[model samples]
Target: MQPASIDKQINNYLPQVTVNQKKAVLTVVKTFAEQDENEYSEEFKKELDSRYDEYINGGKLVSEQQAKKRIKKIINGKSK
Candidate 1:
């Protein structure tokens, strides 16, 4: 069956389902979504690791006061 047909069928039957059944369906959907969320590409992982290494090595480091000033300048549209 097509997705639209399945969706229409689900919508038609949802109102007839018990509250516990609805909660079960919601839990199943959240599990599927969380599985997708945990999958990431190797290249993305490498990039994240590289940024973390730079942070740990103090590369491109800025003081808290300097960071706040830069943020304020950017928010005020005065960043160069």
Candidate 2:
């Protein structure tokens, strides 16, 4: 298998989450990390930044319940 595919398989075998969950996490993190602030329109940036408040407070990420809720909301197509 290709390196990328192999890495995906490994991620799928992660202890807790299923393959789809791992893939979704990878896709979101990769996409979000690659985004440029300028790519967002003013309104979208404002809203998203607000929603991310719990994910990042005091410039530190707290990836616990707050983060999980945000992820679920996004996955379910719910807007803030």
Candidate 3:
């Protein structure tokens, strides 16, 4: 589906959500809007999955909250 369609669906659901839910939904919308198709190709996903597995195998396992923090850190650490 098109980005506009996705945005419309998400916006339709956002108003009835809690504040935290709104923030999360907006963040998802922003990320989807920002991504480039080529930048998120299948090869890229496979490599990222491999890296995540390596991190896990290296004893870098974290709780859900910790994982979220580290994921943002890792994403921000990359040079876009």
**How accurate locally is residue 14 in candidate 3, as Cα lDDT from 0 to 100?**
72
Weakest 10 consecutive residues of candidate 3 by summed lDDT: 32-41
- Residue 53 in model 3: lDDT: 90
Ranking by lDDT: 1, 3, 2
**Which is the leading candidate under lDDT?**
1
lDDT of 3: 0.83
Residue range with the least summed lDDT across 10 consecutive positions in model 1: 71-80
- In model 3, what lDDT does residue 56 have? 77
Model 2, 1-80: lDDT tens digits are 79999889876677678779878989987888778533878899898988789556655665699999988989889653
Candidate 1 per-residue lDDT over residues 10-46, each given as its tens digit: 9999999999999999999999999999988889999
For candidate 1, the per-residue lDDT at 27 reads 99
TM-scores of the models, in the given order?
0.57, 0.27, 0.32
The lDDT of each candidate is 0.94, 0.80, 0.83
- For model 1, the stretches where C-alpha displacement exceeds 4 angstroms are 1-3, 30-46, 78-80
